[model samples]
Target: MGHVFRTEQQALALDSLSRFLKAEVEPLYWHDYRDTFVPKEKLLPVTQQLAEFGLVSGVVSEEYGGLGADWLTNAMLFEEVAFTSCDLALLVLINSFGAYMLEKLASEALLERYLPGLVNGSRFVSIAISEPDVGSNVVEIKARARSTGENYVLSGEKTWISNGAYSDVLICTCRTSDEPRGGLTHFLLDRSEHPYEVQNIKKVALNSQSTAQVFLPEIVVPAHNMLGEKGEGLRNTLALFERSRVFVALCAVGIARRALHEAVHYAQERVQRGKKIAGHQLISAMLAEMATQVDAARLLCYRAAQMIEADLSAEMEAAMAKYFACEAAVKVTRQAVQIHGGNGVTTDFMVEKLAREALILPIPEGTSQIQQLIIGRALTGVNAL
Candidate 1:
């Protein structure tokens, strides 16, 4: 990583996004989840605003109403968005991610039909890859999509998916063949065409727009709906994951920054031993470590994002960024809680909530353990996962 977080103009743009989060998203998004569901009324307005923001537009071509920026710029944008609310950051992320994979690999016809809607935020889409039996192992997917004469019968259940409850379009990973690496295939299907069940997952310390389980039981889709060539599902998905993991790093960057901000503020005003806590040597040391670690995570994300922009495979770089950044976030947030003392676990303090949210970071995209496996392979030249 060049250690450059952003260009001057990009920094200004992100500053503007930070202001938008404080004014528009912070009040409602931070505390609004219905049981386990995020209300559409809250998500809709912000999503529509995001449509005009060009984060999602960066993935598509200028001919298709996108900014067409490099993947690194999009990753930076996600970092800023994550600072506002991790749940809200995911909305922008899903928008861009689903759009990116489709525009890159799906047919021209499919792009024409959905890019406008997706880019404009008229419709929501999500990538469906994880299943009950499968976590980081993409090849072990039990979801099957058999091609019939004119259509494919899709039957499977996907869990831990972003936007699973509300997305109208699902970029599904399905088993298309029995071949080793090429057995899986991608499909861009309209959920309206096939009635599927969705159950919102209840979780702890989660900052997600919406998380749900999608049940695809004997659903049918047209032959044209298949994304890319048959038997390339895992390949396409891994390619996307290499980039997506960088965004996961940025997500940690945003979250860790917020935790640092809250802790610094609280420390300055908190009195202990007849003095401000921040004046204490130990408290200042903790703050210094947090700032340094957050910067390191951001730099790693930038390096991975740059690799992606250069059209590199970037599996090792992405895993390193994702693993280190997320683990750092958990550590940073926990320390932020320690700085808050007994109030750290209460609803009155943001650090308590932020700490809880940080707990969810090491699980999504790929667990910290999975990222270690990927990194271990690159270092030792041995496949670990």
Candidate 2:
């Protein structure tokens, strides 16, 4: 609940990342890949660059090829990444959390096998949880991994899987039992070894990133590929969600902040009634509201991040931050578009893209409705979901 200021190391790292973005990634993103899917070949280099700053697989310990930064520091770096490119931010997020889970749950040999490529960004990873039928209700997952002799036959369809098409490894959630919450388990599936199918799913925004349908059709996975205990998937996943939701909230904040910047820049340059629109009372008021909302949302995200770094259970706080920030992004980006007037809808400007990107924020992590239900459960001690 206390305010968390950035440490000197985090500040320097942020500065370095900002410089790198402006100098290298920004030009590349705008020049060739803003409106289309960024190829894995192009993305891997940037991922490796990010790894140098301890961001690609951040939050894992230094002993296992990570920076060992705290959650708040990682959140700070993550927001900066999102500001430059939300698409890349999502990729970094998947890699970071995927590595986090690997470090926390994988056996020593498993970690030894995967951690090197992941840390260096030579390999891409994804966490497959959502399915064709399952959304917020994780217990309803039908993806099953039937045990056999020293191997499990995995069969399931995981949809809305980020990095699915590009992933070399997947941390897939599967149903290993029929005991509701305890039935879910996670499996580490190597694409070369297990051979699952993937098809990219096109979307309204953030197309520079891959969102795909992953089909695991009776893939043979060795028993060693099982992540954690058989029934501990839900608990580990929920724990990851507490921290991951905060990072998602920060992504929303970054988008809104960029939108605000665009609006302010446009308002000051555009003339209306012989004066800059920024001087007009209405435009000024709208800018004020957008700025205020962005700041408030960012503060909420940081609060949740701080709580997570302090080793606290941030379920309710994470839900609150994710709910408020994502909703605020929708509002803030729309206002940015309104400020841009007729030009807002055109592809010539970046505000339109920001608006489109913001639209996707409220749905990921959890829907705004889901976050509200989580807060409701926290406050009333009643399970709303």
Candidate 3:
């Protein structure tokens, strides 16, 4: 229960990553091309360079060819990535989470086949957990898997899957029985072997990241591909999500930080009434609020990360962090746009893109309303769902 939000070594790591982002990512942001999806040509090299820095699998265990860093370090790295581009950070997050789950739960044979490539960034993976009907109700997911001795046949559709269109592998959750939440099971699906279909989803925000709806028609997965024990998929996936929620919270902090920085720069240079706009009390108040919120959100995110690292049940903490951080990001980004005046609505200024991207943080992983329910359930011991 000790505080895990100390500066110490994490400060050094944050400084290093910040420097890397400034050098490698900031200059690449061009306002001319405001595409919804990141150009693959630009994404690949940056990801490969990040892989070289061991940022992709910083949380994976050393036994799985990773740095074996703790959650605090992992959060720091994720925040840095988010500062550069939320889209790129999201792509890395999807792949990292997939790899972490595989390493933690997959059989040795499965690990040997996928973990190294995944850690090295040679192979990317996506998780298919949200079905069209399931949405936030993990227990209501209708995807089914039938066992056939040596192989399991999976049939389901996953909507809004991150990195679905380009992932080399997929970790899909399906129901294997009718036993409430305990009936769910997870499968490691190799796209090369299973002929699945992926349809790209176009969205107004997070354009640089690929989202898709995946179709599985009798996809055959080997028995060894099963993650953890049968009927434990719901529990296992929830655990993974708890960790992921903290990471996403850090991303929210990063997004808000970047937007705040841009707004501050713009405020100082923009003039009105023959003076710098930043000199005005109203604009100065907005910037001050943005800075305070960013700091508070970052601290909350780090607290959740520290709890996870300390082997604590972080359900409430994760929900609080995710909720507060994302909500704060939305507020700060909107204020950033307002501070920029007329330039805020135009694509020429990066604040417009930042504002658009901020819209996705509250919805993904879990919605803000869902987080409230989670925290409510924890505090009152009532199953609101």
On residues 74-149, what C-alpha lDDT tens digit does candidate 2 reach at each position?
8888999888888888888898889889999999999999988988888889899999999888889999999997
Please give, for residues 1-385, the per-residue lDDT of candidate 3 as tens digits: 1233546777777777678777877666443235555566776677767775657668778877888888878887888889888877888898889988998899998999998887877788899999888888889888889999999999989999999877889999999999878999989888899877999898878766789999998888888889989999999989998999987888888889999989999998999999999999999999999998998898888889889999999999999999999999999999999999999999778888888888889998989999999999999999885
lDDT of 1 by residue, 229-316 (tens): 8888887888888988888788888899889988999999999999999999999999999999998998888888888888877999
- Model 2, stretches more than 4 Å misplaced? 1-5
Best first by lDDT, ranked: 2, 3, 1
Q: Pairing residues by index, what is the TM-score of model 1?
A: 0.95
Q: How many residue pairs clash in each candidate?
A: 0, 0, 3
What stretches of model 1 exceed 4 Å from their correct place? Answer: 1-5, 31-36
Q: Which clashing pairs does model 1 show?
A: none
Instruction: Report the Cα lDDT for residue 281, model 2.
Output: 98
**Is candidate 1 or 2 superior in TM-score?**
2
In candidate 3, stretches whose alpha carbon ends up further than 4 angstroms from where it belongs are 1-9, 27-33, 39-42
Highest-TM-score candidate: 2
The models' CA-based lDDT, in order, is 0.83, 0.89, 0.85
